[model samples]
Target: MTRTVTLCEVGPRDGLQMARGRMATGTKLRWIGQLAAAGLKEIEVGSFVSPRAIPQMADTGEVVRGALAIKGLTVCALACNLKGAIAAHEAGAHVLAIPISVSDTHSHANVNKGTDAQVEMVRSIVDWVRAQPRPMRIDAATATAFGCSMEGDVPLDRVVQVAAALAATGVDRIALADTVGYAHPALVRDTVRAVQDAIGDRLHKLHLHDTLGLGLANALAGLEQGIREFDSCLAGLGGCPFAPGASGNIVTEDLAFMLESMGHRTGIDLPALLAARALLRESLPDEPMRSGVAAAGIPRTFHPAALAA
Candidate 1:
């Protein structure tokens, strides 16, 4: 029997945030529908932030409403602050991902707050959600946990401290993120271990970027560390506005194939996922993409390497 891994698609929110071209709300909804049809149970639909800052996610509410119609699909939205969290909840988002930068330099640029304040932001958001009539899950991802382009290597002790504070806030789950794609396999394992030591079972997911072409390698290291949930984008679409020259997250189609080929169950149809990639390509023609399985098609006689990923 093969093990199961959960791949959360973040194309709509994280992928589109850095793109220069604007995508229509209806196109976003349709693409989301395609992703859901591809057997992606969890999808980060959009973010609820100010239009002046990121006009790309201005219509997150509408996207959330549309995604809710997809039965059995978990609609997630990225929220920066309390206002964003409330907006997401009202829009029917099932999960609220609060991206907090552990690197002070990155924090100031990305969320305009220091590390401590961001932890408090999580506390506030969690409190607000608990008060809501509907139940919502919180995924507090520590950005730049591996290293920071602005601040350089973030020490493991500091990451542990930050994750400890977040865990103390009574949040549901915590994720360590290679926000700028600066992580390697060894660092991936080490960071996962340190955060787990701090947050214990609260640490679960990894939000990775492939800026240095180490996305899949690092993700493989993460799976070796007993992590099951990973954040990825279809067609390899993503970037950090604050981290200059940083690339997208791991490619969704490629990661799916890699895991499934390793004998782990992802429940995503590769052909259907590629077809959804067509929708993403048609929607964002000018966006740059680099994919492994796309460039080199799946082999004819490939054998799975691991019994489980």
Candidate 2:
């Protein structure tokens, strides 16, 4: 078997949610298609939050429906509660990720509820999904797992506790997210190990941000900790509005280069990914997009065996 890495493209939701302008349903579908064409096996198409709360994601259902047409790809959507989960499941998303903010302050700001309340809601959400005729996959992501911008450094134990809580909810996966980008390499390694110890193999994913410029370093730490699935945004566009000083997510193009250079197969075509990023930049002209590989260009000397195939 070829050693592989899964890169979950989150630009369609996390990246676009905070942008200056909203993308039409047709445009969002076009972007999802481009990402799927570039060989990304999974894409976070959009979120199922209330339109009044997040107007940008109002068309998430349509985006998921359209993205389902792409062959050999998984469509995912973000949902914070039972209501949103139903929408995502009804929209036919293959996976629905619920962000369980570890910080009470961030949690209150994000969903108008604290961490305890958030945990209490998980079982209800899971039960409701199970009752559905075709329940979608669930991923309980521990957002702000690292240091919360609102509440200094979060204890490793707290992060692990939340992961355990999510695991008890019968979620399919649990991902640790550096929502504010405040983690160092050691923290990532230790936290991942602890989460695994608490929740077993359910700790398979990491969602990182480049806010403090440690995105790649943390990702390297995660890989060393046996993590394979990563969440990144195209052109590094996104931020947590509630988390002060938060920046865009880890850059997908740059991350793909890093992973491929290290002999891991990601199945993403560098040229095709750049083309997709260009289209995104064109669509959101005013939205700031960042990609080290995009700005500096890929080194001609670097070629991975996976890309050659």
For candidate 1, lDDT tens digit of each residue in 1-309? 578899999999989999879889999999999999988999999998889888999999999999999999999999999999999988988899998899999999988889998899899889889987899998888899999999998998999999888888878999999999999999999989888877787999999998888899999999999999999999889988889878898999889988888878888877788788777777788998767777787676544434334
Query: Each model's TM-score?
Result: 0.96, 0.97
TM-score (C-alpha, index-matched) for candidate 1: 0.96
Write model 2 residue lDDT over 144-236, tens digit each, in one string: 999999899898899988899889988889999999999999999899988988988999899999998999999999998889999999999
TM-score of the candidate numbered 2? Answer: 0.97
RMSD score of candidate 2 (Å): 1.3
| Each prediction's RMSD to truth | 1.9, 1.3
CA-lDDT, candidates in order: 0.89, 0.90
Per-residue lDDT for 261 in model 2?
A: 86
Top-lDDT candidate index = 2
